[model samples]
Target: MPRRGIRSWFTVRVTTALFTIPLWLDLTAVAVGAIQGAMFAARLTERRIDLLGVALIGVIVGLGGGILRDLLLNQRPAAISDNWYLPVATAAALLGMLLLRVFTKLNGLIIALDAVTIGLFGAIGTSKALAYGVPEVPAVFVGVISAVGGSILRDVALNLPIALMHVGSLYAIAATAGTVLLVVLVSLGVNVVVAAGLCVVVTTLTRLGSVRYGWSLPEQRALGSWRVWRRA
Candidate 1:
């Protein structure tokens, strides 16, 4: 090969390897999310925890975020193109099913695991966007979406109120906050791994604290209707 050709090939190989970091991040996130999804399905006695239901929810929670993120970035989703993605997801789902059978009460574990995945996905997504030369603000949005998109899909699939739209444990807010923290740390010359670790701690602590303390964002009521009622 010509020297220039060799150099170009090497550059492409290195770049592709670096990009695989995000893929691995998403894969691990999907596994965690799948376990949590199965746990959630098990918790709902009404859902009856069918194998098919557990597997379906697992797949949704596993792949939905990355698919959406990739589409938004105008890149082909790794979850679809990568040969290992589906098998990993399915295997994780099966492991989750097995865990469900072993653990009689998994709610707390599920919540904790879900929080961890949120942080992982958020950090990875933000890093990816920044690597791709995305601006700070939009990168933050991408991070938040990558964190919460899977859970949102899970909610929709289960016919539950979408977690992002509801006054629940600060899901999107936690993701955004973590991603912002990560971006700031990276800008300050912190190592990306350290920044990601900090983000995971921040996101997990915030999410778990919100759930523990029953914290919620303030609700908006229709003051206009109340005023008319009082006048009448």
Candidate 2:
């Protein structure tokens, strides 16, 4: 019947949209992460990292988060299973390295992209954990790990101080906020895709605001001193 045909068409369109949106978003995250990694490596003049080293670092940054997430969940990494991921990451890294000067000049743009990258990763990670029946709190933890795992690996590889441990922009906090929001929204019957999009927006705004305002958690020593003074 005409009604049946219309319903079938709508269902097909909706299913296709759901599948394609996440795929594109994941690819976008990989590309941005690779570019950011390449730029970071290129800036470290003292390290004298070669093109291959830069590319490797880029790949690690691009794929590290998802790998960590899967490992924590006791599953094989999706990045490894998918063919598109590696090629996209490598190409993006090369592009970043080749155009280092241009990207460096657009620092603001890079920061924005970095924010978006983390948001996407966090959303994807949290959603996946929930899909696998991970509890709410642990799902948030996974999301945070996925958001920051790449940078953690990069710092370790480069022998730099771990950014998460130091006073810096609220990277983990932003991720937590976003993931929590996504969980809450989903519990409230929001569509997963729509919730994920909102999560990205919240995370992006939090990250950008933190950078603009120099917002960061108090240093450990500072917090200790405050506690001592309060006791006094």
Among the numbered candidates, top lDDT falls to: 2
lDDT of 2 by residue, 134-161 (tens): 7678888999889999989989998899
What C-alpha lDDT do the candidate models reach, one value each?
0.76, 0.85
The digit string of per-residue lDDT tens for model 1 on 1-232 reads 2334423433454355435565576677788877777666756777676888888788888878877777778779878787988888878877887787664476677778888988888887776776665666787888888888988888988988986776655988889889999877766656666777898889888888888998887554544467645864
TM-score of candidate 1 against the unseen true structure = 0.79
Candidate 1's C-alpha runs over 4 A off are: 1-26, 42-50, 104-106, 222-232
**Model 2 regions more than 4 Å off:** 1-21, 226-232
Question: Which TM-score value belongs to model 2?
Answer: 0.88
Clash pairs, candidate 2, are: none
Task: Provide the global lDDT of candidate 2 against the true structure.
Answer: 0.85
